[model samples]
Target: MSDAQFWEMNPTATEILNEVKARKIQEINAAYTAEAQPLIKEYPLVEQQSWTAQNTEARAYLAWHADQQGAAPGTPVLDNILMGRNGETGTETLQQLCLAVIENAEMFTQFQQLTGKRQRLVKAVRAAEAVEEIELISW
Candidate 1:
């Protein structure tokens, strides 16, 4: 599914989309090709492949899009302080919310495939103490 659908599913993402996008970009380009890459506009080495280059370029562009669309408010975006009443101390981060949304029973598999973070997502879902506390039901 397109990234847009992800945001659509998790409306809470709007507040911290930058964090989510930054994270997703890293996941998308963890280990790209070295030299055998695809060439979309510029040029690659003689030993490079167009398909690989194109894929890398595309992923990077998507990452750039993620950056543009989902950058945090500051350099240390993850360090935001949360304050609420009724002793609600734990601050469910945007990444955590994204993971929760990704792991929702309705679209777990789709998000796993789309984000390619199956292990992390699964682990997070399993570790979350209050998945239900984070409301994803849009109305």
Candidate 2:
């Protein structure tokens, strides 16, 4: 509204305008949340694939780790495989296994960093009081 028109508004009209503005803001916030929710939910899966693709050794270890029922890090599984124990043949050389473990560790560290950044973005989105503030947030 023009300053002159707004200044001339009756109390009832001003009240109604305020209510309309509040409602519009609520709708904008809801829409932003709807758009952001799916991205938050699917981020891990999408990032995992992307990260693994960029790190070939990490990808190989991931597949092998899955076949081993998702072995935890710091386990003696690699040693056992090297020693030909636990029904695991010494198929992978020590150097290959070591590289896989190192690469996997590095990949995991990167994943955690990205995930933490995403979580912080989520917090910023939640705490924002205006559409413009929320719009500044990125994944």
Candidate 3:
């Protein structure tokens, strides 16, 4: 509030200011709680980083393969490349490429599961009416 406004409401200004401060503090606490709650309790940061890195690397591989094949980057291209249907073998052997494809698919599935779980948890946190309720949510 401006100086003039504060002085004008002087009689109840202090009380109103204190109430606003309290509400602000509560809001800050709630935000902190929501963020501090880990999506995965064990090695949360490492797990999250691993998921992101794997997903990124897989996507990059797909894009690179797509560019090489002159087609769109997606599972179809990945399948064709792995199945030796593209006839454009580069370095890795068929077996090795197949294994990598399987690994990438598995990682993608895990990443999706993690993402869905985190989204649900965030929704629950936002729906919580109190900090205590938010605190109850876990990975």
C-alpha lDDT of candidate 1 relative to the true structure:
0.38
Best by TM-score: 2
User: lDDT of all the models against the reference?
Assistant: 0.38, 0.54, 0.54
Q: Write the per-residue lDDT of candidate 2 for residues 1-139, one digit (tens) a residue.
A: 6556755765475454454444454555565556545544655665445444435544445566656665534424455545763255446764465565566557466556555655566666556655566556554
RMSD of each: 25.7, 12.5, 11.4
Error of 3 at 104 (Å): 2.4
lDDT by residue for model 1 (1-139), tens: 5568756776564434444444443443442222113211244344224333333333444454466776533312112211221136675654443333333323323433434443454344344344342222111
Assess candidate 3 and give its lDDT: 0.54
Mind sharing the TM-score for model 2?
A: 0.36
For model 1, give the 10-residue run with minimal summed lDDT: 77-86
- Candidate 1: residue 119 Cα off by (Å): 32
